[model samples]
Target: MNVLSENNSITETAILVNPNLGHPRFLEIDQKLKKKKFQTCLLFISDKRDPAYIRDYLNDRIKIVPILDYKWQSQLLLERERKEKKGFLTKVKHFFKRKKKQISELLSQKKIEKTQRRLESLKSRVYRGSPIFPSILEVRSVLTHSIHDLEYINNEYCIPQDYLIKNHAFETLDVFYEIKIEFTLADELLDLFRIRNFIMFDIVQEKNGITERINYHSLVVSKNNWHDFTFVQATDLHLAQRNDRIYGIIKEWMDTFKIENLELIEEAYKKDQKTKKREEQAELFKLPLKRRFVNPNNQFRIFIKLMNRKVFRNELEFVVLSGDLIDFTLLSKLPKDIKKYVDFDYDFSNWKIFKKIVLNFPQKKRRGVIKGEELLCPIFTILGNHDYRPYHYDIRWAGLYRKLGLKLEEALAVNDKLLALPISAIVKSKRALRAYWSQVNPLNDFSIKLGNNNFIFLNTGSDSFKNFLDLITGHPSLTGLTTKQIIYLQNLASHKIQQKKENSFLFLHGPPINPKGKRSFLKRLSKKISGKIITKLDEFKESVIKKIGIKKDTRIDGKFNVKTGTVSTNWSSLIEFCKNYCNLTLAGHTHSLKEFRLDDPKGLKTRVFNAPPFSLKKVENPAAVYYDVYSEIYTSAKDIEKAGPFVVQTPALGLGGYRNPDLAGAYREIVIKEDKLDSFKVKFIDR
Candidate 1:
């Protein structure tokens, strides 16, 4: 029987496969629901096993129906497999193959300097071992090995060696049958599902393994069946301890670090040495750096107000905070003298402050109603450099060189803290976000399904730096996605694109790819020269001091101080991933708002959007800021929309006094239709 409507005729019946046990209602559905064969869409909603495992298990029962695997594990494993296939040899072949014609053309031109340079480039591409690539290869190798191991163990150990399998013939049971299912969706079904009808169902069973019944829910329409999908993006809140002793201490140190205020710094340092003078030291932390100081309470209110806005409160489904939720970088250990003044028990005051900020955000507000809903939308966040930077100890050059160790466990703790606090709040604040972080990795990378689209969040800060130099001040701090993360995302993208034909977005705290042709040559050159000089000087000092058997007080390492969002290197894998999988990539570390369109040789156009700081006072790269960005950007949407695939840099949300004597504060309202980008506009807010 077909339920006919004017727009869509529900001729095809979707089969909700129960892989665990055959539902008693399955017979009823097959006997009564429709007249034709049960061969359209197969949907499996299982929390116990993965979609792949379920689909593979139920393939025989559901025979001809196309399956949609919503399982996160299957997606990640598939990505890992694809990445492993591209071994070193494959990469080398592809590289040479791609550049073969170019190299031939250059050789024919007979331009010695240019041709020689091209040959050298090819050599480096083949031989130059990047800190990023090997790690990725290792992860791929491990994952591939693990998959193989699992199959081997199940077949060799369980089948022949295990007595249970040999005696009972459990492997031959119908439940263990390998079912055939189409990995790709049929064109007609794809067109039908594109209308955004998600049929949710569950399988129930008795303890004895007898099928009970199948429970089905109404089809979830896409955003009330609206054509326009609206979302708000904010980043880099950098909330820190305010009206506290720690704030004062850090502020005094930050203010005097670069200037000729050594005397005052010395006075404060000595005063902080005395336990009794702690309050006086705290008083010294008083500075007029408004941009850096954001009270969590105030920011929370601002978030509420922003969400309360008619534009957002009405239809805003999700909030994406790219990264840098806090500004406090963890100090490893205080100097001996300073430690004497600080109470050891009070070390976690900063974290306590952050906890309050995150945990207290979801409380029932005094304000009656926010827009039309009492609850805000779901907010998803990734870790920025600042989020975990504080958890790492401040290593003096001598200390760093002596031990080339990674704080793997300690780093995990910090990452957990960062994600857990927000997640806790999300759970408690039931009205706001409806999603859960069930599939998030230890590094806080995960893929979430919303409506018909997939949103993948990456922890770009993880495995970002190879050496201690990257942790140092003024060293190019901008980083790329980890190898494992890249592969996972690539696989997910491929799966969704091939099977579902859905739009996929990648979110990270750091910009994996910078805008094409957006760098200032002279500025870049000057920064490189200065950075090299500083590094060399630090190296010399460490060597000289080590030779003399001196343990110096290198506590004030220059690495502690830095402006965020400076790109030092281009990660080829990230660029390639964008070229392949990402329909839209959003990042927000630079604190500067800008956009660019990536032109790939494969004709894949990925639009990149860099979010502005949610609360940073000054942007890292001031040149990107405009005196009249507000007016200039008023028509950017239409202009950029016309320029094909594009990238957009948004403004910050709080406090701005930069070079141009203009306030930089803005949020973006992005509109997405199906998988293609519809249009976007920067909504500037007064700080």
Candidate 2:
């Protein structure tokens, strides 16, 4: 019989009849359910133990129902007799099995160590001559307390040092701030030495592999020390390449769902038709749709004029477009012309439209965007989730290379270049932007020095796989830095600090922390459970293979493995770096204008500035959407009658959701004084 009734969909009742499962296990289940905020009646079916035995374990929050079964008591008696007869033999078998398992575990540990050693050797060669880090000794000295050569693990790899520092730097920085000597010479020389105050230092390597430090403050000009520079940050542009493209995307989506939800699709189409009517009536003012795609020129014209006005005119340094530089993908919506899809093809028509939209910004002769006096500053950009070709396509996908009429590698190359071309061209055209991207890790990673300050720009979109996973999980700033990349950043900052830059600033598409907490509790919980299940299944498979005597060597993959790798999207590393090394970080994926000052254990604080989307139209708000598929998958009419929809609601997007009345379109002006953070002010542009 089922423990819980098949008709009980809401999990309103739980009956625990197995006494052998133990009180701890019984109470564990109770607590787990309660943590999920489930309301249920718990009943214990046992004659050996009274209901009072579990009463203390559960409180007023859970309802207790008692049912004593005499048949269960007879079953227990039979089980005890069976155990008495076979317990010794079972114990003997388990003893040998346990011994074998222990030996297997030791061999697995050895394999893991051997793999790590090989990977470390490869990294040492790849990361040799790190410009920012002169030597591993320097990084280790700064990151960890003094340790002997024998005590050092993976001394050749700087990754271990990064982990040590990332884990404890915030707490250590807090201590300095608590003592009120955080900025003093001792504290400055120790904690802030490489991250901040070191910009004046020059490293001179001696013949014995020791590095001598030299300060170059005298060689630097006084005028260059001028700290006042302002830059604007706007994120999540979601620029639609063309007005027609939007209609096409929606139409395709409606077509896909027409058979199942015709009414819903029809309603959405009608809404689109109504919007078109409204757009015609409001010709005097730009429609939101027009502003987003059809005529962004006028919208951008208004914004440029505002920025060029008397109050803001002279203060602007440059503009940073955080992400979502485009709308739609290469295989946006599969073409409906084909009955049976044999191959995937680039939606060239959509690409052409997108190209036109991007060209409008760069073509000097284009009419709308460059209408008034153009702002001469360069605009630096990073890709958002939408910028890439579709990572997940329907099963009908036959692969883009076959459909695009190109070799697999050629198709991939074309996609890569096409996705990045517009931003690349824009960056190349501006002298400032060109110089910025040219420095250190020339691809999507860049570092620039403006006077005494260092700025780092990361391509969060490059880690497409991790980023895609993050989106499905609703994690903010899911793009993670690679261990090699983190070390490069460390070296970059080290050099900048040695050059006497006041502080380093990081620019990226996603905020390090989710502005809103992980949106769906159920999704997160399910992900956790699924991850555990996958891990166990992998282990089980490995064990079965070993039992069959099929041995395989353990290997370390190139990608950063969150379980065994150095860097992750944990934000603790970013926070620790900012708290100890860098000054302020600017991000904008959430499309909300907000400032965050994270506090350490002490009074020390690290600042994060979040920018609102530059585009007038709203993107899909992740938090506002309600998804019940996870809960629904486990419940059906037979499983839980009258369970409603088994819906799971996420936290609503506060100011960032589409069509929110309060979203007046905003940007932030960051003021830097003496290379240190001065203030970040949000400037709202009301349409």
Best by lDDT: 1
State which candidate has the highest TM-score. Answer: 1
Q: Write the per-residue lDDT of candidate 1 for residues 189-251, one digit (tens) a residue.
A: 323232222211222211123222221111111223323467777665554442122233334
Residue range 438-518, candidate 2, lDDT tens digits:
110113444556566666776554222333334333342334555544665556554445533355667766554343322
Worst 10 residues of 1 by lDDT: 133-142
Measured by TM-score, how close is model 1 to the native structure?
A: 0.41
Alpha-carbon runs more than 4 Å astray in model 2:
1-226, 243-301, 308-312, 328-375, 390-442, 462-470, 473-477, 498-501, 518-571, 602-664, 673-676
All candidates' TM-scores?
A: 0.41, 0.37
lDDT score for candidate 2 against the true structure: 0.32
Measured with C-alpha atoms, the lDDT of residue 130 in candidate 1 is 10
